[model samples]
Target: MILKDCQRAALEHIRQHSAARREVAQETIAHLLEMSNIAQEDFPQALSSIQSHARVALHFHPDRLSQNLTSVADLLLTDGLYKNQFETFLSNGALSPDKGGYRDLWENGMFGEVYMTAHVTPSDRPKYGALNLMLLPDGPSPRFGSCYFLLKPHVLPRCTFSSTGSQLNPPEKGTLDTLDGVLAALLTESFYREFALGVHNIRTRQLIDHLRDNLTKPFQDPSTQAAARNLDYFIEVQVHGPIWLADDVEILVADPSFKRTKTGMLLEKICEGYDIELFWHCGFVLNVEEVPLDFRGPKMPSLARRVASGTFLDVEMIGEAAADLKRHPERWRDRGPYEYVLQELKRLWHVLVKFGKPNNTQK
Candidate 1:
């Protein structure tokens, strides 16, 4: 089927399975459909005209959505601290905690910002948030890391209807690269948080083993860290999520004595402000794989844009999450709306180029 047709089918599925979810699903699917159309209109030869690094706009389940949120957070955080030696870098004033600032996805709904929120409450509101379209260039480069990523509230924004349509919301954009110092601090904290929280949970901690396995010479390459480009600015969208910190975060963070660094002190303060489960949502365009034309959405139902679910609120509930995943692994892989639109477009293009042939030599 065509890309638009696929979207139509998904919309129909949502309509039948759940009506209240129809509107938001419509909004998301419609927004993406419109973007696909715009890309084609703007480029004429959509796929080829599109740059490899072009900003593409685009969410998921609570256990699933929340997992995506954390992974995105990890992508931004780890990307920020990729090369810095975590050991004495902080004390050397290389990365100061005072640098980075957090933009609440709930408040500053901009396009292109690497952030996303999973509504743990309502099962179908809107999974994707605004993409930060502003690109002023901050420095540091993608080769350096997630310079602007910071931990903020995980709460979903209040859904409001506007006839304004899907204009790329570019929030106050100046420099995302300059926040590296601040992002380093949060990334440091996340590493430790994962480590500490994992000590009490098996599955969460197993993440450490995975990290350690991948630590040597790209062993963990498949587990995370997708690929790269010729320039140092080239970076692969690294896969990251909750993992057990069986050892100090220094293992992945590279900071030997992190608890004593200035970052460590700052992390303590940041943790005090929000509930323990709170995390910053990050969304960004990256060098990604060509998902299959027949890519199936994850197995879960759509999530409502409501409050964060209390089910996975505390570390204590980590066990519950593991059980949920173990019991029904299928639900965890439900195809997301963003993936559907993206892959379907590629599929549509393939179909046309193969059967809808035309002369290339100016007949």
Candidate 2:
């Protein structure tokens, strides 16, 4: 099936399954279908144009949304520290609005800024807060993170929509290089983060053993390997309800040493805000592998050339590569010669291209 057909099918599936959800779900999906149609018209080379990394995620909490007066912005405004990070980042100028501030996504809703030039990463310090910190955890260490503005429900879409660079280079620079790379990276990271969260639930020794097993496992099946080589792109439309802290967070808060620490204190404040079971309303992943690729490379940025011909890393390879970086930080630490810093930056850039299938396998 074609990319547009796949997207239509997924939307139909959601329409059939989303009756239990609030009206927000229906509204958001309708907007998405509109956007898809617009994309086809906007890009003449729709079959081969670089697929934009876009998704709409629904966020709802029963208690939080119960009162008609309790707006999303209101909740963030009143909620103690942790939940207010998004607001703090904007107000303090740590993050600025994108060139075009707010454009209407629909009659009632608007798409917000891209914040910093970079894509957000899940915090290494999960105990601190459920914050998706922007950029790598390098430099002066940004205190707050970037997330969607919590607009009120009536005037709000009740969803956050984001479009970011696939791969290419840091600060989410997009090019033909991101075509397959972006899709692979997003799916791999999502699954990896989810699995790592599972590790936090299990015993440390058991988790280590599991990782060890994963490390040792080889790509045994020929057919599976071939399938992995073929690239696919999809939008993971999802409705996430409520928010809850993990057990490890609670244990850490119990320790006086941890309680007094910065991350712990912030986490404690976040924990104080909400406690409920995790909920999700499934959407769908539409296959866009059939989309064509025929962009001119010479007109692209100089940096795009670097990623155009290299071997793109796989999911397991990315995990292993990341673990190696953590284990040996000194290799890239401390500034030295100009050439050395530039080389290290390039190396880090390659490491950061965390999406899609390897270029060698591109079909």
Query: What's the TM-score of every candidate structure?
Result: 0.17, 0.21
Q: Which candidate ranks first by lDDT, i.e. highest?
A: 2
The C-alpha lDDT values of all candidates are 0.23, 0.24
**CA RMSD (A), model 2:** 19.9
Error of 2 at 122 (Å): 24
Candidate 1 lDDT at 114 equals 23
lDDT of 2 by residue, 1-363 (tens): 122322233233323333334244334433433533433232212212212211121122111121233423344335431222122222211122222332111101211111222332211100112111110111011111111212112211111111231111122111222222222233234334432221223332232234334322321222122111101122211111221222111111111112233423433444455331211111111112311133222211232322232333222222232233334446534444433433333333223221132223312
Question: lDDT tens string, model 1, 46-72?
Answer: 212111112211111112112233322
lDDT of 2 at 348: 30
* lDDT for residue 273 in candidate 1, whole number 0-100: 29
Q: How far is candidate 1 from the true structure (C-alpha RMSD, Å)?
A: 26.2
Candidate 1 at 20: error in angstroms?
23
